[model samples]
Structure formats: structure tokens, C-alpha cells
Target: MSHRSFRALGVALVVWSAAFTTEQACAETPIEQARHVFETRKYTVVTVQLVIKRQYSFGGRGSQEREEKQEASGTVIDPSGLTVMSLTDVDPTLMYAKLAKTQGMSDYKMESNVTSVTILCDDGSEVEAQVLLRDPDLDLAFIRPSKKPVQPFEHVDLTDAAHPQMLDELLFVNRLGKVARRTYSATLDRVEGIVTKPRTLYIPGQQNQESNAVLGSPAFTLDGRFVGIAAVRADLTESTSLDKGLLAVVMPAEHIAEVAAQVPPLESEGATDGGSS
Candidate 1:
């Protein structure tokens, strides 16, 4: 009888331990759960598009300005349509010129780089978007979809991606925006090299204007937490044009506290796009 009683107690204790663990897991905070998801499923990450209309000298400079539309990509940083983009996508001078005209506040040229405005979702959807804030010196921008758009996307938080260590498996989502075909699942070969340039920027097609910039897409660690914001893919050696075919650039968020503090916590906007090439 004593032996049987001890056996029953041991079984009961095992069951109780398992039950307690499950309860703790189920009671995890949303932030904690989000972080877990980010770490495990970063591949389904999403990006957005910028629909910018600008006028520039075209056709061997007939000395005439022609209007043209250009697109760029962005990473959905939140669920309410807030996103991160490459400030290099917008010419600070042009954004300022456009801003001046829109605000009717003053006529300023090159004063505001043209945040030449437009937006697209990596799931092949297009939404008009506007620049909310910019750090031209750092080549970073925050954007919001216009007309309160709804789209599917996934958001990632920026963590310590720049930490020196082994280069981990990562992914990129590229959106072409009617100019070219969409390409997904471009892997980040490494994260070990450090860039010393102060003003790194991307010009989607300058090196090959036909290339794409899934502008605001997030560069995530294998765990899916946002490690950086996708910027232009440019060669450190050339610095004059983009090399989208062989390279990609990013805005490390760990170093953006100064810029982020200048802006408000943006409204939320995003959805999941977790899949692979």
C-alpha cells in the first residue's frame, strides 16, 4: 500500500509540472510572443513601394524637364501602415521643393529634398504614400501609406544586428513596381563587414535604373526581428551609382536613437507576408 501511494504521488507531480509550464507559455505577454514570432518566421517578411512622380531633364537634356514616375520599396515597421524607407530614395532637395509648394508656406528649392512621394506593398499592391520624417544625412526615412490604406505585411523590430559575429542567414524581399518583375528571397550573404561611410545611400537604378528597391522592407536576422531597414544597394568602392545586382544596403536601427527620438511613435499598419523564394 505504501509503495502504490508513492507511485501515485510521483505521477501527480509530473502532470502538475507539465501543466504549470503550459500555463506559463499560454500566459506570455504579447510583446514576448511577438518577439518569438519575429525570431522564428522572418522569411514571410513584407516590404512596400514608393510611387514618386518627378520632373527632370530627360532625352539628352533637350533643356526641357519631363515628368516621370519612379518606385521604391519599404519595410512595414508596424501593423498600421507605418514603414521604413531609404532616405536616399528621396532627394532632400527635391523633397523640400515639393514640400514648400504643398504647404504654401514658402517657395524653397533644394531646401527640402523631394520626398517625391509614392508607395507599394510587397504583396503586389500599390498604395499612395507620403514621407513622414527623414534623415538625409543617414539616408533613412519613415513613410506612411496615404488615404489610410489596408494591405498585408509583417513588421520586425530593430535589434542588435551590428554586433560583431558570424554572418547569419537572412532574406530580402524586392518589389519592382511595374517597371520590372518582382524578385523575392534574396539572401544576405553576410553581416560581418562594417561600413565606414557616413552618408550611405541607394539609387535603385542609377547603376542599372531598371533594378528594384523594395524600399521599406526589413533586413531581419534569422530570428526575424528587424536587424536593419533596407536601403539602396550600392558599392562602397564606386559610391556614384547603385549595384543592385550584387549588393544591398540597410539602415541599422540600433544607431537611430537620435533620429527616432525626433519623431513620434508612428501609427500602426502592416500584415504578414512570410514565405520564401
Candidate 2:
């Protein structure tokens, strides 16, 4: 072939490669677009402060009581300050009970009482809140502000949700700990599997371990559709091992919404503070 002909062919190939690379680089993945939307909208990812008191009894060993203050991530589901988070995060009595039984501690007993509940707002304000309902079967806890807010607060619309399939990538948002200034952060996770029997559950990929997603964080599809909240499932059957039974799964938003609908209207006064499940 002539040198001129060879030069023209090489230049044509280079231009084609460059155009393809640019097109690929310009395209954003679904999760990436969802992240942008969440960031711009300033989704309501709040911090929940829980003050819990616990009493422990070990048969003849007698009883002991203690109190602790903890913070957990929660997603605001409505303008009225209705929030949802992992029940286990607020109270771990059931988890402890399972552990004790697993260890064959027939005489072990434990109880937890949520002494105080507060929602930390983005503007550095604190809103007094209380547990409105608790669903242990689903590991979900719904909370609401004690008093009506002067103005509606920003929240995620769980009704507009997405159903993810196995291996599909998803996005979740959570608030960082105090050390990180309690900033809202987003992470990407893939659906490792889907459980259809009993109830629908999305098993997040192991990559979630390296992510900042914590219990109660809201998950969404790459298209920015609400998926559900992150929670731990504890199966305490005699045949199931603890390691295999307890799994981090994303509860379907539909289930959450159905349960949320069951939450009674906010009372004129705060609901009775009781032990969280």
C-alpha cells in the first residue's frame, strides 16, 4: 500500500477510538445520576439520638442496670417528621436474647428501655421525637416528632419506589458519625441476591461492607427511585446459625410504606416512652 493510504487509515482509526472513548466517558451510570439528584435535593438523612437504660439479670448472679447514649442514622419518610430506622439499632434486647440463647445461657435475662429520643436536624436544631411503632418481625421502627413542626420538613417519598433485581446496582444515603461532622453521604451497592419466599428482601453485595451505609439508611435505584431502608434480619431458629441467620438486607419500600400507614396520628402529647424492640 502507498504511504499516503496507510497514513489516512491510521488517522481514521485514531479519530474513531477517540470519539468512542469520549462518548463512554460522558455517559453517567444510574447510580451516579441518583447520587447527583440526592445531593442537589438535600434529602433528609437525619441523626437519631437514643438514650437507653438496660437491666441485666443472670439467675442467682443478681441484677444490674445501666444507661447509655447512642446515635443512629434514620431516614425521614414524611413532612411530618415521620422517620424510620432499624429497630435493632435503637434497642438490641432481642439480639442479646438470641445471643444468650445461642450460648445456652438459660438463666440470662436482659431488658432495654428507651429513655429519650431526639432527632438532630440539619440546621443544628434538635427535635424531640418518640417511637410511634415498632415491628420486630421486620426489624423496623417508626418515629415521629413529639410536637408538630412549624413547617413541613424535607423527606423521601417511599411511595415512589423501585424494585431491584439480582445483580442490579443501587444507591443508599446515610449520615456520618459525629467524627465526620455528621455529613450526609451516599454509597453504591449491588443486589447480591433476592429472597422471594416468606417476604421480599434484597441482599446487598459484600461491597456494602466497605461502604458507609448503616442501619436505617434509605436505599434507591440508580434512577433515584426509593428502594427501601437497610436493616439486619435475625433468624433465631434452632437449625440456623447466627452468622447465616443474621443478614444485612434492604426491606422493600412497599412493606415499609404499608407499615408506615399503620402508624397512628401524632398524639397531642408524646406517646408513652417504652422499651424499644
Candidate 3:
């Protein structure tokens, strides 16, 4: 081979290497930015423990009652330990009723009552909390410590939120279940679409088990701006098909903040029952 030909080949290889490096860096930029938000705000994600007593009745068939303890992910929305989570997770009777109707089981009836509530902190401590508000329309529940924490808690500032366009990527942070040691985890999802009529809702792209995100996971933009929280929107219209009836959406943070603003003071804890429909 001629020396001139060898030199030309070497230059081509170097150019290709530089181009590949630049492409790789650009791909990593979003992930690195998202990592900052995850590490800084992971503590805001916590576990909520609930003991619920449920009653089930099959018309003229029989009735059953059971008490079960469950754990769900919750996001701290205020420094005072005010947290928010999916109301459906705490009480799934509504969802069950919808499913039953869809399956042509009109005789199915179910009711539930939250017997106890506790917030599990990252430091292995537990705080007794009570449901301050429940919004079934939006699938949101606000809870606060029975007694204010001695020190301020790390929380997400919902007021400072970002509005993402369709096809934009989002970062979601959540806490794993007991089997996974309740560790904090993160996942990425894209804004699949936006529903503006009736009410504005952001549709997230398809999620799989590997994402490890749950109902209460908080979502953010790639640049570390708060986006919203994951929730389910159930359409109860009889004409609506089951598949299209229930939708998973990212409820805007501003909407959540509006509801959080209505949370009653701790003194009036039992004014609104969380389990009531």
C-alpha cells in the first residue's frame, strides 16, 4: 500500500472517532441533567402505610369483610411534611366497581375504610399521619403528619413546575416496595400526547415493569423541572369501552397544588373522610 493511501485511511478513522464521541456526549446530556434532580429530590419520595377494612357484597349471594395492610409510594409536597399520593391506591373500590360494571357484574358492591395511616421516612422512622383531603375526580390524596415534624422535611415544590410539550421526555422518581427494600428509583418516559378538552391532562408513553414507577411517582422534565404525578383517570360513561375508559396520565403539578391548597388544617382532621366516595 502507498504511504499516501495509509495516511488518508488514518485521517478517516480519526474523524469517525471524533464524530462518535460527540454523538455519545449529546445523548448523555439529558441523563446527566436528570440525575441531578433524582439525587437531590429522592428523599421527597416516601412510603405510605395504610390499614384498611373492606366489605364486599354480592347481591343476595353473600358478604365478606377483611382488614388488610398496604404500602404505597407518596411524594412530600411541602416542607411541613404535607404529602400527596394516588387516592385510588389507598382505596380501590371505585376502580373495582368500574371493572365489575364493564364485566357485566352489576350486582357487585364494595366499600372500604382507612383504619390507620403512617408515613415511613427514609431514616427508618415512622410518622403518624392522617388524610387531609381526598379528590376522587383527580385521583389525589393529601396527608400530613399528626404532629408537625421537629425539622423541616425535604419536599417537591409543586408551585415551581414545568409544562412539557408532546414527545418531550420526563424523569419520574419513586420508591420501591418492601420486597425491594423501599429504595428510591428513577425512570424515563416521554409525553405521548395531551388531552385539553374537559380538562388538560398529559398522556405518558407506554410504561413497562422495568420502569418501576407507581401511581404516586413524581415526574420532571429532563432539565430538572417538576412536571406532575402519575395518576389514573377513569371514564365512567356507560358507552365508553373499557380499554379507552381508563387512562394513565401525569396530572399537572399546578392542578395538584390547587387541590393541596384546599387541604383542611390538621385540627379538622376528620372533616373529610379519605375513604368516602
Candidate 4:
């Protein structure tokens, strides 16, 4: 072909390629759109840690020993550094409970001590965090740390009326401190029924504590609006996989007000909460 003809063909090809790229960029599905939002705004979440105090099973009157356990989770609820997590995960307050291995009652004290929480952003900025509030029954915690907040996140929409399609693909984002676990999906086999406080799988007894969903892990529809704070699996019936019973109670955003009424907010940078006995 002549040089002029070849140059014309190359220019036409470049024009077509640019148009295709624009179309692809604008036509992502809702889930794909949501994932891109998270990837761009990941800098606003953080991981928390604390020194949890535990008394020995023995009826000791002095020299109490402390256990320092670290938990990793994520949050994107606020521009003021507020984070979201599992309600039962971090408790710093000391409380009363029965002594271990005996009929004797004793004080089971704990503290909600936060070491440091840092938000890793895409722009190479790491922001620190602190605890805010957590709902006991619903199992969601709101945290905020001490640092200049980053830009507001691409907050998910919370529809007043929404329904989760059965067998639909759901996405869950998990975190381990500063490290992030990849978002995963599961097939909703069945409804398994609902409860007043979305809890772990167990006979409604006073002493069955087998809750599962990781704290701060958010569950959502393919469109990415709020669905529920992850709840524990409810079925203990034998299945091919152990995870068959580990169901997370997807709380609708409307229920957020009810949970807030029960668990009031605090005004300190330190952490505080009592574990259920």
C-alpha cells in the first residue's frame, strides 16, 4: 500500500480503539463499579488492637494476668475517621462473671485498649485510628482514630426497601489489622430464618457462644448498597463443608437506628466494652 494510505488506516484504527476504551470504562456492572470505588477509597479504613485483661480460672485476689490479643478489621463509615467492625470483638471494660471450673462467682474484668489503627491509602498515606462505638446485640462496631481524616469514601447507598435474591452472589470484605483479605463470595443456599439480634448458630440457651462472621467485614448486594453486618452461622446440622453452618445475618440499613438506640456513643479516644458471659 502507499505511505499515505497506510497512515490513513493507522489513524482510523487509533480512533476506534479510543472509543472502545471509553465505552468499557462507562459500562461496568454495579458490583464492578463498587469494587472500583473501594479500590480507590481504601485509604479510609483501619485495623485495631488492644490489651485484653483476663483473670485466671483460679479464685485469685491479687496479681491479675493480662492477655494481649490483636484483631484486624476494616471500616469506611466516616470522614472523621469512623470505622465499622463486629460489636463483640473489642471490649476493654472489666465486668462480673462466674469463676472458671467452679460454682464460685467472680469479677471478669476486661478493657478496650486500642494500640494503633492505620488506614493505608492508594496515595501512599497511612492514617491512624481509634475506637468509636459498637452495638452489642447486632455485632457491629464504629471506630475512629486520631489523625487528619482523608477524603470521604464512596459510601454505599442504603435503600429503604431492598430484597436479597436467593442464591445470589454476595461479596464480603475481610481485614486482618493492616493486612486485607481479598473479598469473597458465597451462594445463599437458604434463608435459615431470622432473629431479633442476628446471632450465632445455637439452641436458644443461656450459654452457647459459637458466633462466626469476622468483625468489620461488610456484606452487600451486587449493586453494593448496605445489606447487613456479618452475622454467625445458624445451622449446626452436619454438611459436606464446615462453612455450611456459618451464615452471616445481613442486616438491612433501616435497622441501623434500632441498634444505635441500644448502644449509646462515647466521647473518649480510649476503648471500652464488656464481653458477653
Candidate 5:
């Protein structure tokens, strides 16, 4: 072979090698960084359980009474054990429907018949909590311990909110249901777009792994900065029924921090009017 042809081949091989190394480095950095973040923040997430009684009607038989339990995920926001969860978990519309049926009333309205609520910690301990308030505008619910904790609980600082650009990679963790031992699984997702009309954020890439059970899970940037909370944007059971299918949205951290800051002062001043036991 000619010396000129040999030199050209050598240049091509070096370029190819450089490209492969760059691709590998780019791929590994984000995932490893995300795993680190998940390990540090996983405990801040908790399980929420609600117990209530509802009435269900049969075709021929009359309505029968039964007790039902619901479960969801929440994020701890403070040392006092203040946590935030998805409003849909205890949505007034659905709760009122159950209540109306139990009362044998025909009108449909919003009401609460929750008999009890409990928070499951990472170490497997449980704490009873009170529902402070549910903001339908934000579609979030705030809850706190009914009694003081023996030790300060682990929480995420919303002040460290992360802002990522479109198509940027991010990290989130989901807890398996009791049937799956309630273990944590880390997922790598991306920001697909942003909505301005409703002041919303969209994550269309993580749809398949999300479920109603994982609502309110905390999301973080690739570097492990807390970004926001994940919520189901459409009907869980009827995803296809919606024109856009099921969308999982992450409420921005700045908005959540602004809302969460209001709760502590209210509790300190002995304001209990907004709470539900």
C-alpha cells in the first residue's frame, strides 16, 4: 500500500476511536450520577395509607357496605415529618361519591369520609398523620404527624430546586407495592417539554414506568438536585381514553417550595381549621 493511503487510514481509525470513547463517557456519567442521587434521597420518600368505608351497589341486590384501603407515595419536606402527596390519592370528588352512596343520597358532591391515615417510614415504622390541606389548583395534599417524633425525620430541602432544560436527563425513584416488598427502583427519565398556559411541566418519556401508586414521588436532576414531584396527569384507568394518553407531570420545585413554606407557620400559630383528622 502507498504511504499516503496508510496515513489516511490511520487518521480515520483515530477519529473513530475518539468518537466511541466520547459516546461511552457521555452515557455513563449521567446514570452513575443519578444512582448516587437516588441513594441519598430515597429515604425521603414514604408510603401513605388511608382507610375508609364505602358503599357499592349490585345490579339486583341493594348497596352493601365495605371497608376499603388506599395506598400512595409521598415526599418528606421537613424535620417535623411534614410530607406532601398527590391530591388525587384523596380527591374530594371520588371520596364524595363514596360518601353519597353510603348516605343513600342521589346528589354527587365533594366530601371526606377518611377514617384514618398512616405514614410508613423507610425502616418499616408507621406514624399516624393528619391531612393539613389539599390544594386542587396544585393537585397536592400536605400532611403532618399527629404527634411529635422521637427523632427528627429525614427530609428533602426544596430550596435546592433543580431547573433542567428540555430533553435533559433526570432521575426518579419508585417504591414497589407491598406485593413486591415495597422496594425502591431508580429510573432515568427526561424532560420532553414545558407548558406555559397552565404553567406546567411535562415528562413524556417516563410514561410506561409510572403508575397512580407512584404519585408524588420526588424527582431529581442527573446531578441529584431535587427538581419536583411527579403526578399522574390523566385518568389512571383510562389513559387511552384521553386524547393525549396518560401524561406524567413534574410540578416545578419553586412552586412546591412556595406552597410548602406556608404550612409550618400555620401549625405554630395553632391554626387547625384547615386540617382534617
Candidate 6:
């Protein structure tokens, strides 16, 4: 073969090899990893609705009534439709604080009227859910759907997930806002560090604009193991000045399972009475 032809063939081979490697890397990306995990566990993540009522008196006037609706993400844990969501969803103190300041009300009080707690299913159907327990320490709440579906719902076994180490790559699943068709987003982040004071935690590297949306969303390892759920920690120790930001942390699966096991069982049938080890 001519020298020119030999050089061209070698270049073509190199290009092919590079292209193949790039494709492989893309397939294993954190987004892809998150998608794979979600596809299998889609039914576990659900939408929750909370009905709130507010009572306030202005300028020595009698108490008046105000109504509000709030929504949040929850994770189903059992066939009986046990689920967990953020405590702030049902009890929003910060939201009320802002409202009080804005309206200039002397006495502002808000409580969950909770006329109904509806659970949005994976198949786009809705069902009634009931609040069973609230753990203030963890800032987590447990709930159960009132009626059982014909087919058993899927759930994430928190104990099954592997414990993550520092700097490990992980993926989390979060649903878009109401304007968005409730589609889930797969987020990739590195474990920036850990804090051992309150509990063993997995902290994300940097804060992003979408960080608030991912709160209460479940995080997973690349191989599809549940690491924990995304939580926020506010550090005001150093900052007496004014600016306050939230740091994302992973509430480890083991800890979640331990707390979940103690939650009371539903009144319905076919529920697991055994503790989650």
C-alpha cells in the first residue's frame, strides 16, 4: 500500500476508537444512571397535596380565615402504599413568616386545615392519603394512601441501598414544577463533604438554582442503589451579617429505614408489620 493510504487508514481507526469510547461514556453518564433507576422505581415517587388554613387578626379585628394549597414530592415505601415526605410540606413556618411580613398582620397564624391529603399515582390517577406520623427531629413525615390499588405499588427498600463515601458520584430524581407535566429530572452531583453533629450526612458539592426543587427527592448511586433523600442544612453560625443559604445533604438510607420502621402501620390490610432492618 502507498504511504499516503497507510496514514489515512491509521487516522480512520483512531477516529473510530475515539468515537466508540465517547459513546460509551455518555451511556454511563449520571443522567442515564438516574433515568435507569427512575424507570424501575417510578411508582415509588409520588405527588402529595396539603390543604392549609390561616387565621389572622389585623388592627384589633376578629380572626379572619384564609385558605392555601401546597404540594410536595413523596416516596412510597410499601405495598400498602406507605410514603414519606418533607415536614415543611404540611407545616410551612417560613412561608407563613413571609406572609405575615408582607401583609403587616399583628397576629398571623397558619395551620394545615388538611381537608384532604391526595396522593398522585404513577399512572396519573389520584387517591386519598392520610398522615400517620411526623418526626420533628428528622423533619420527615409518614403517610399512607387510603385505598389500595388493584396491583401492588412499587417501593424503595432503604436498607438495600449501599452507604456512599465522600467524593462518590450520585444521582437524584426530582419532579418539575406544576407548569411542567410533572416530569422527573435526574441530577448528578459529587459528595462534597460530611457533617457528623446531628447525624451522618452526605453533602453535595455546590449549590445550584434548582437545589430547592430536589429537596425531599431520593438520591441513588450509579449502580441503582438508593443512597438517601436530599435534605438541606442552613449554617448561620458564621454568618450573623444577613445572607443565609442552604446546603444540600443526603439523609442516609440506613437512618431513614430505621426511623421508617418505627412509624405506625396503616389501618388497612396486607401491610408489613415487620420492622425494616
C-alpha lDDT of candidate 4 relative to the true structure: 0.46
RMSD of each: 11.2, 6.6, 7.1, 8.7, 8.1, 7.5
How big is the positional error of residue 16 in model 5, measured in Å on the Cα after superposition? 26
* Candidate 4 per-residue C-alpha lDDT over 95-150 given as tens digits, one digit per residue, 9 for 90 to 100: 11211112234343433444444544435565655555556555565655464454
Q: How would you encode candidate 3's per-residue C-alpha lDDT over 1-277 as one tens digit per residue?
A: 9999999999999999999999987788777978888998789889999988899987667889999999998888888899889888888888889888877778999989887899999999999988878888899988889887998999888878999998999888999889989988888889989999777889888782223257888888977778888888887555668668887888899889989989877666663445454
Best by lDDT: 3
- In model 4, which range of ten residues has the least summed lDDT? 200-209
The residue-level lDDT of candidate 3 at 59 comes to: 68
Query: What C-alpha lDDT do the candidate models reach, one value each?
Result: 0.49, 0.83, 0.84, 0.46, 0.72, 0.69
List, residue by residue over 108-177, the lDDT tens digit for candidate 6.
5544445567887757888877776666456567777766567777778865886778888877777666
Clashing residue pair totals per candidate (backbone < 3 A): 41, 0, 0, 16, 0, 0
Can you write out model 1's per-residue Cα lDDT over 146-231, one digit (the tens) per residue? 55555444555544443323454334444444534654434343454446467332222222233434445555543445556655
Query: Model 3 has how many clashing residue pairs?
Result: 0
Between prediction 1 and prediction 3, which has the larger TM-score? 3
TM-score, structure 1 vs. true: 0.52
What digit string (tens of lDDT, one per residue) describes model 5 on residues 1-277?
A: 9999999999999999999999986778666878778899898888888876555554445666667788888888888888888776755455344345554554433334567778888789999887777776676888888888898888888878878889988777767779877788777778887766667565636453355545788888877788888865543232233335446688777777778777754246443424432
Off by over 4 Å in 3: 1-28, 208-213, 236-240, 267-275
lDDT of 2 by residue, 1-277 (tens): 9999999999999999999999885797675687686785445779999999899998678789999999999988999999999988887788778777766776788888898999999999999999878888898998889998997988888878888888888877888889998988877779998999899999987866433257899887766678898988887755567767678899898889989988878765346663444
Which regions of candidate 6 are displaced past 4 Å?
Answer: 1-31, 56-64, 94-109, 208-210, 234-245, 268-277
Deviation from native of the Cα of residue 26 in model 3, angstroms: 8.3
Better of 1 and 6 by TM-score: 6
- Candidate 1 residue-wise lDDT at 155: 58
Task: Give the range where candidate 6 is weakest over 10 consecutive residues by summed lDDT.
Answer: 268-277
- Give the winner by lDDT: 5 or 6: 5
